[model samples]
Target: MTTATRTLQLKAAPLIVEAEKEKKPVKVRITAYTGGIMTVPGWGPVIIDLQGLDLPQRVTLLLDHEGRTEATIGWGIPKTDGKTLVIDGTVTEATDAGKLVIALLKDDVPLQASVGVETNQYRPLKPGDTITVNGQTITVESDTFLIEGGILREVSVVPLGADKQTMVTLAAGVRNMTHQPAPPENSSPGETIEAKYILDLLSVCGDDMSTFRQAIENRLPLETAKALAETRRRPVIPPVLNAEVKDTPASILAAAALKLLGKESLAEKELGAETLSAAASYKPRTALDLCGMACQMSLGYAPRGTNEIIRAAFSTTDLPVALGVAANKIALDAYQQAPATWKSFARIVSAKDFKEHTGIRLTGDFKLEELAAHGEIRHANVGEETITYKVTTYAKMLMLDRQHIINDDIAILDQIPTIFGRAAARKVADLVYTVLLSNPGGFFSAAHSNLITGAESGLSVASLAEAIAALRKQTDADGLPLDLVPRVLLVPPELEATARQVLNSVELYRSGGDQLPAGNPFAGLNIALEVEPRLSNTYFPGNSTAAWYLLCGPADGSFLVAFLNGQQGPTIEPVDPGADKLGTGWRCYIDIGAAAADWRCAVKASGA
Candidate 1:
């Protein structure tokens, strides 16, 4: 390759190096060795050689490989120099007269500078050509050019060096550059250097090979590790069956399985097998026999049979007992929490479990005897009267599909108990309200002589007081005063406001503008005012919205609401597998009823 050289002469002016505190440029000649690969600091590999020859040893070398020009510095390298050069200039005029008029920047302040141009062929300077002076580069920033006074070019220029200074400022504004040690040549990206070093150190410190082998062997497979963890988490339970038997019933097997599955009490091996056998087949297999056969088959100890398969098919899948218990709990909780609207007013009596409840109310009193003057005494005939109430069971069944159990969708199943419970409570309230409104016992009829009729008269103080007096005047079969006191005034929603007014007012107002001085004789009466929504609209033919009642105290038992003794609320029962038509369902039921016990305890006023 042929090598060429060109010399570029810079202005022989004082070049002050601010970083080195030097005042003047140094004279030096640099001889470049060409046509060879050389590595530059900022520029990558290039086909150029730089060799020989400079002046002061302190001067730094800078090369513009593309321009093929070497600029020598007297104090420091341009790359390393901390001082920045800013060229802000405008070329006002350029001429063939070898002079140019321009505006230049000194210390960031704009000033005028005259630059001389040397050309042999009288080449005129233009507005847009880039130029450098004293190592400061500038760009023609504006298109405006003016020629005056022998000047050929006039333009605005911005210093390019300012761009470099800006770049440095931006880089400094970002995160600090920290020098990180180079990674090992053979190591992967994620490999820990400290760990490798520690291992090496350990190997050098100890010569025990057995420990190293043990450490390697200690690493377990993922599956093995998981299995070990699972084993540790499982609770240990003692075996319920000590010896294996040849013929085990399906129920016994189920019970044993349940015990193993963490439900010991509900296992009920004997009872469960017997119930299932009685329901499923005439010759039923015992739970123990079926389960034992299954176990044996798993161990190759016995052959599989149709009966075993059937038993497995009916298996609870470890959820029956748990679900049953949970359902019972949910039902009981829902029952207790359900709103007791009418039940709150009626008297509740418990009935024997699975049996009818009887509420007895005595209507007649003992006969009073009169004294006799003769030797013989006179005796009055005694009479006994009784009213009986009985409650019957109301049942509902909910079915679960096989898919639900298989998918473990038990949350929906939990709602069954609560739904059943709330339904039972609502039934009880409806029954009580129905009884009161229907007055089936003639409690509100004229036969009972408690119904007061007058269409023109609405609920007024006089009318209510009359009703109360009539109730108090009621007598038993012995012709004695019932001694009854009105405890509550039951009214329809339409009459609730009128009832409160009549009971709460401190003074009574007459239709003729007359007022009673005893400021509301009903004040401090403490009589409970009850508004029954069911009574607002007509339920039965005579059930009137304008009707109201004066009832005896709750302790007097004018009305009786009865429930099964032990089964007061609601009960949830898991259906036996064989007997279950749907195969997956439970029964929820309640035994409750309500009736009017004694007509003497209350009186009704049919409001007009």
Candidate 2:
């Protein structure tokens, strides 16, 4: 006769159980392999047995959901006399036969699961053994187990969280329920998050959320926000509490709350409104335009009528920096407009390209000698000399009243920079001119360089001709004739008429001569007469009203004027606003030095 098959249905309850509360059971479908375990949601697993039911019968089993238990099966029908068969146990110790000595606890009695040599392949277990049976955790507390015929006997068992002592002992190996919870959605693992990313997240909450989110997000510190909010006159309603509000994005919630309290956004407010408008309207053209755009953006913010605020915002712009730029432009214009007076007669050299200082070497002149036929040539050592000069910086400061900036009169503000620039130009011209005229010894004193022989009589055709002859006859350090020709006749304003008459005349008259038939010795001379006021200025030491110079070509290096290479003219810069007494004044300066490098290139005559 064929035995009919039976169906055994299995189900698991939630791991946490309250006897009085009802919970829906999770159905467990058994597959062909009964060894596979099934788990309950928010719970552990359960093992089922489907082979024991009688044919055409339905059986339901209720399993312990929260307490400790071992894997087992009942050998008889429900509610009938039957023996319970235990299959799992806690390992107590290893036996000499290489088996795990196990014990089962049932009604406080001991049963053993050791099979001696037959269980030799099983790993030897130690006291405090941990093992899982049908999702229930079990621990072995003793090394000894009462065993009968290789079966598991009584063993001590404890629930995982039944007591504080058990939790403390198991916490090292497992994550205890008291450990910190996992990160929430939209949260990261770092201590801080990017502001932009936070802003983006707030945007996702909704446009209206901006008011609330901006309150907290715009504030630097929570205390500051609180203080600002406390000062507001109007009472703000606290946000409504609900599921959606509770779940609102963190950034949006923060900003919205701040908006409600009427706390200003520091970042937005600090950037002035004018700057923001400028930035929005600005279109970048060159690389400089890009810089301009950045300046506008940096200064852009809420509008405040205070001059300090407006100036502070503008301080971040290129305008203040442009002050120095304007100064430089002014200096350049001044240098370009340099008078056609002294510079035309003096050699000008740039000093800026020099790293620390510049030097002018005056080499001794070389002399030519007739060479002997096939004989060794004699070498003459003309020692070299050097004159070193360094650049000096000059500066001036100007101030603008705080009230002027407040008025926002750009026209008034503009004039100061231009004035500063023009001032720098004037300073440069004055410096170069002073250096050229201040030293009379470079021209009139023979002891200076032998460029002058002795004090000549008053300015006249004969006196001028004598001075030119002296310059032509002068020799260099090598005792060779310099072949110098006087090109410019430098004089004071008092002698202009005499210089013009002497140079323009076609003939000369001698007061003591009886009769002389000859052409004018001063005629057809291409000498440019330059009248400089500083020549007779009493400020310059040793300058005489009648002192005059017959100067050679500038290329001849009779006098040298050096300027810092790229900075051939004065430069303008803003005084450090913090250090300046004049809050709005800028400084203009020039770096320059001048000296007569070689006096032999000109002849000086102390006129009577």
Evaluated at residue 603, the lDDT of candidate 1 is 82
Candidate 1 TM-score over all chains jointly: 0.44
* C-alpha RMSD (angstroms) for model 2: 31.8
lDDT of 1 by residue, 1-608 (tens): 83333322211122121221132122222111111222211111211101111111122222110000111111121111112222221111222111111111123332111111000111112444443322333333322111111110111111221121111100000011111222234544354435554465345325433223322233323333334334322221111111211112223333333333333443343235443333233221333333333323221122244333323333322123323444555676678798765543467777654344455545454555565677576554555455566777777767655544344444455467778878887788778778877877577767766878887347888888888788888888777887888888888889989998999887665666564465776788757887877676555444677888888776777787887653467765444333333234556777777877788878888788
Model 2 local distance difference test score: 0.40
- Candidate 1 yields a Cα-based lDDT of 0.44
Q: For model 2, how does the per-residue alpha-carbon lDDT over 467-530 read when each residue is reduced to its tens digit? A: 8887888876677787888889988899999988888867666656548755667667778888
Please report, as a residue range, the 10-residue window in candidate 2 with the lowest summed lDDT.
167-176
Which candidate wins on TM-score? 2
Model 1 residue 320 distance off true place after TM-score fit, in angstroms? 2.9
Q: How close is candidate 2 to the true structure, as a TM-score?
A: 0.46
Task: Name the candidate that leads on lDDT.
Answer: 1
